[model samples]
Target: MPVSHPDPIWVTDNDTLATYCTQWLKLDAIALDTEFIRTDTFYPKPGLIQLGTGQEVFLLDPLKIDNWQPFAQLLGSEQVVKVLHACSEDIEVFHILSGNKPAAIFDTQLAASYAGLGHSLGYQNLLKTLLGVDLPKDATRSDWLQRPLTDIQVSYATLDVVHLLEVYQLLQQRLKPMPHWNWLLEDCSNLSNGDLYPKPEEQWKEVKRAWQLRPRQLCVLKVLAEYREREARRSNVPRNRVIPRGSLWPLARYMPDNIHSLSAIQDMRHSNIRHYGEEVLSLIEMARELPGEQHPKPLPAPLPKAAKEHGQRLKRYTSQKAEELNLPVELLMLGKILTPMLRSRLEYGLFKLPEQLQGWRRTVFAEPMVEQLNQPEQ
Candidate 1:
């Protein structure tokens, strides 16, 4: 059976939004979400900001209303918990609009994972799981930037937050008694604390097949990637739009010396060559001039045959521990985190807890994991 929902209150002007924000400040929690477009830009183009305080839903038009100070306060207030689901991109929207992400957040997708309901549940699936509500999917990709949004678009946006408050309430109840309750809060707090802009120098680590490069080649890649990162932000364009990833590795590998050499690399666009050819060559020259000792250590190779057996042991131990705790293995210890730890162990001959595993995971799994590795094979 279909359920009826109230029409979302549309707040387009400054005063109306400020008045409602004052009212929202009195609430214990609010459900929040955003609709944005990011097809070609470095930053997301925010179209709509949704807020539900249980009594009413408000759709704040990003195209209108300049006053975000009151709402920014509401978002940052430690008194009110801002509930969201899968909110990484939404955090970017909030930061761009209001100048800060929520100071306090209860991410339902993360909460559900901790509550043992499921991992990475979509908003629609979560609503179905908790409230038996099936949302229409037709208007999901609608042109939100267009004015006079269709009635279908409005309802779809309204339905998004209507059930979210209820979901937060239920998840909170489930989490209240768990031993890892504080761990969840700590993790949620980090969502807002994370730096919005990553360091440009470290961007080289993200290039495809980066580990294949020699140390000096890595130094060149690092310099070029840093330039790309800075230029992408400066021009407000995608990184690839600044320079494609495919072209970057070859530039480092060949150590292209001039515009002619730079242009010869596969996937190197002519516009990039024309626009940035001189600057790119200068950065490569800087890398070449750096002393051998200044170059980064060579990227670690694949695990040796001996380390492969140890990695399997670590994997089996982590799986068994996750099962015992009734925690999702992916949540408890992701492969990204595990691989680095294994690499450090292979190099140092001792298990090293990664910085990511420093919190509750260190408390729960660190000792046991080390013990499992230290024990002789049966």
Candidate 2:
């Protein structure tokens, strides 16, 4: 039988939030979710937060509450597990609000993947699959920041956590008996503990066509990307607002030295040219003057056609193993981890295990993956 959930309590002031948080601190686990807008800012603009204690759902208005110390302490309490679905963005909102990441977290999406439910399953689908509940989708893009939320929007937000608590309970029953139960917790911990903010120094690697640039050219792109990242954060604007990413590659390749040359680059906005053209030229000049040793190491080129067979073989073996284990292939052998391993073997002629593959994966597939890599091409 489906459980009848109570109406969500609206939390508009600090005292109510603190009082409920105190009671919630005593619970073993709680369901959590956040509603935020991120169309134009480097940081998400939090609008509402929803929490479920298995008994009642609470809707917290970020615009109304001031003190979050009590909730911060609850989030930091290692004894209590915070349950969320697809928690990456929610983690960011929590950190921004409380200055603390949940000490313990269980992400239902990841949990479902581990349980062989599906990879990257949407919350609505997961609910329909596990609990036979259908959620309304009308309020997904509604303005959550606006005051006097519509009744439909409020119901949608409340159901986000209300059904989540049920999902958590169902997944717990399915996963607790499995050997990989702790693995789900481990991955969730890594997700929450990860640095949500982008690092300026490493930002260049994300630019499209960045690998085409030579070492010295890469240095110029690196500095330009760093400047854009820093300026975006400082001004609370999106990265492209500072300088369009499409312009970075051309600026690096052409080594633009003046406003005219900089302006000629593709996607270079007039505002960017007028504001940052001088600094861009100066950065490029400084990069050119840098000694050879200071240049960034060259990015790896694409593998030749003949070498691709090795990655294909590794993928085949990994997919078979994932099937045997009743898990998603992506959960077992992510391309980000596999591609770097293949590149290392090609360059150094020896397989080096990446740190990401060192945990439960090491126990499961590490030896076989290395052996597969060492196999000679047919």
Per-residue lDDT over 130-178 for candidate 2, one digit per residue giving the tens place of the 0 to 100 score: 9888777789988989999998888888888887877888899999999
- How high a TM-score does candidate 1 get? 0.94
lDDT of 1 by residue, 1-378 (tens): 375688788999989988988988888999999998888889999999989888788999989988788889888899998999999999999988989789889999999998888899888888888888888877888888999999888888888888889999898888889876887898898888888888998988877778899988999999999999999988888888778888888988889998888889989899888878888899999997899988877777766687777687787888898888888887777666777877778888777777766677777887678866766657
Off by over 4 Å in 2: 1-5, 372-378
lDDT of 2: 0.86
- Candidates' C-alpha lDDT: 0.86, 0.86
